[model samples]
Target: MTAPPATPTVAVRLVPGPGAERVRVLAERAGLRCGGDEIGPAATVTVIVAADADQALRAQRTRGPLLFVCDTVSPEGRRRALRAGAVVVGAAELTEAGLLEAVLRAAHPHPSIPYPELSGVLSTGTRPGGPPAACTPALTARQTQVLRLMAEGHANADIALLLGCSEHTVKNVIYELMTRLQARNRAHAVAHAVRHGLV
Candidate 1:
């Protein structure tokens, strides 16, 4: 695997309490920009501070790969994290090196995190060259906005904020776009959009 094209900017969302300070200090010490609560449009990775499984799960609605520093994570939480493309790092095991490594792996997804249903059917490159617009799917303006924001690495909540709509609207738009693209999930939808230049 290759490293991310650029040094990723990490968004750290803290669970309010004594441990919050510790996370702040650790992130700063590790040279990670503490992009507080609000997820940035350009955020390449995310770190969510959680005291336990529930908190970790609730704090992880953001997009892209994420690292969860939690005291304890349940099996269900692990499954959800896997499906969401996130890693759960036990708080006790957290370290400067570990944090940095998580950030690195987040940028370049590790093979251990399986790409479900991809089946080696995927290819890379953002250059538009699928089918002509006339032969491809047509996207609504809202769908286009959601797809573009998702492509630029914004979460649903961030997309809602950027487009001045509710998260429900964003989800509906994504569902609609995914249906149109015949995609299995958000990543697949974005990939299909890029491949077909439907965005």
Candidate 2:
């Protein structure tokens, strides 16, 4: 008789906190075998739940596929993760199934966004309109301003202050822009804008 396929083991290297406990439960629910803090050869993917990107970078010393989860990361933090070849998934978008998929994706290794809102980033390069335009969609005047500020690596709060709007408004604008451009995050949106010469 043929043997059943082996379930891949993921290393949950989260700091001691409620987040760590939650990840453990999620891993079990996903039917993924999870290992302890020590990430060695046995681990197919190392899942790190960090409070911020700095913590994620610190945990990235382990040599293997890594899935980094954090609340939010700065532009520099994103660059560091990209340089380290670690996949970053926002904590808000992470789930049991998502975690499992992320682990599998880490094994394959590709630049893709895990969030549903920006999932099209890697697949579609054209604007939302019917025909493929010479350039990406033309950003509205407000979006242009926001994109410029974002390209400058300004945080949401700082952008809001500069634009005379609330932080929430800045965040909403960014979300909309990401959805329109299929951008993974703030840094990605800025990159897309720059690539398409919109910024």
Candidate 3:
């Protein structure tokens, strides 16, 4: 039988600017080829520019699976970037390893939101105004229950017991949640869910 073709690799786009050198170094360290030209059909794009709000806005419009690295981005700036299509945003201080990991995540999101500690559990019932800020359509009732338990500091076993399900089932749910949220890890998934009111 013929073997299947290799999947296309994610292309990396490096935004132009004084900080471009640093981005280049990071990309090299990660073994990712640098596309010195404008954004094209790359699976991932990284924008390195002066730490300015306007630059952040421009970077946000580049393409899918985008990452913006700079000194600091305001909350509004982050929101704008997210709205524009950036999957990750951080300061230049973020380590090359961290940036590489973030790129991998943007390329292949996790399967579920990280479970929160039991102490952090919050009510999932709809609030007076509407649904709790962190509940998204992507999350099933079981996944939400698992997330709530995680927030409360419950481990997978504990969550399984609380929900009367198998530990393996709980793990699967968490995986699904992380993937649907496009989170890199449990913490990021939880934060993303909370930020978007899709927990």
Candidate 4:
């Protein structure tokens, strides 16, 4: 007789709040075997939600795969999470489908990355079998901010409002990111930033 498929375990480390309830609902909807605050040894993925992502990352350090959910994450935070062995870092706005995908990728991570799977999270527009592209210089602080907002699907007007800048400035940042990254458009620029973990 064939053996039954193993159930995947997901440990959700969220405080007792609105976000915790939402995460629980979503994880159940995704058909994941959801657990509580601590990521058990049998846990395939750890979903951590914290206002301070670094704190969550630190706590989840030495785990297998981790997905961090936060309102905002700086580039430094991204590096810190990666260094601490997180597989994917995401915004609080990630859809249920997106969260499920993150969990799946964490279960079967990329071999080259060795840390966590980020290709799906970042979505760099590279053709299969081709070398991954690199950002020639580095993105400025403002550009990083704008690109991060873009990743969240914010429009120029909304980005302007959030950044306390003019629409023109937002447009300029998008244009510059596209040009610098050789991206086809704003979405591509955001994808590049995501793939590179710059945002």
Quick one: best lDDT, which candidate? 2
- Give the range where candidate 1 is weakest over 10 consecutive residues by summed lDDT: 116-125
Model 1 Cα lDDT, one tens digit per residue, 96-124: 66666666666554423324212121222
- Candidate 4, residues 55-168, lDDT tens digits: the string is 665556445667777667654565455544454445666766767766665565431232223333444333222123453447889988887677666789999999999999
lDDT of 3 by residue, 56-160 (tens): 665454445666675765544544444444544455556666666556655653312223211222343332222343554457888878876776667899999
TM-score of 2: 0.48
lDDT of 1 at 170: 92
Which residue segments of model 4 deviate by more than 4 Å?
1-18, 37-40, 109-199
User: 19, model 3: CA deviation in Å?
Assistant: 1.5
Per-prediction TM-score? 0.46, 0.48, 0.52, 0.46
Task: Give me the displacement of residue 3 in model 3, in angstroms.
Answer: 31
Backbone clash total for model 3 is: 30
CA RMSD per model (angstroms): 15.6, 13.2, 8.7, 12.1
Q: Model 1 shows how many backbone clashes? A: 0
Steric overlap count per candidate: 0, 0, 30, 2
Q: What stretches of model 2 exceed 4 Å from their correct place?
A: 1-18, 37-43, 109-199
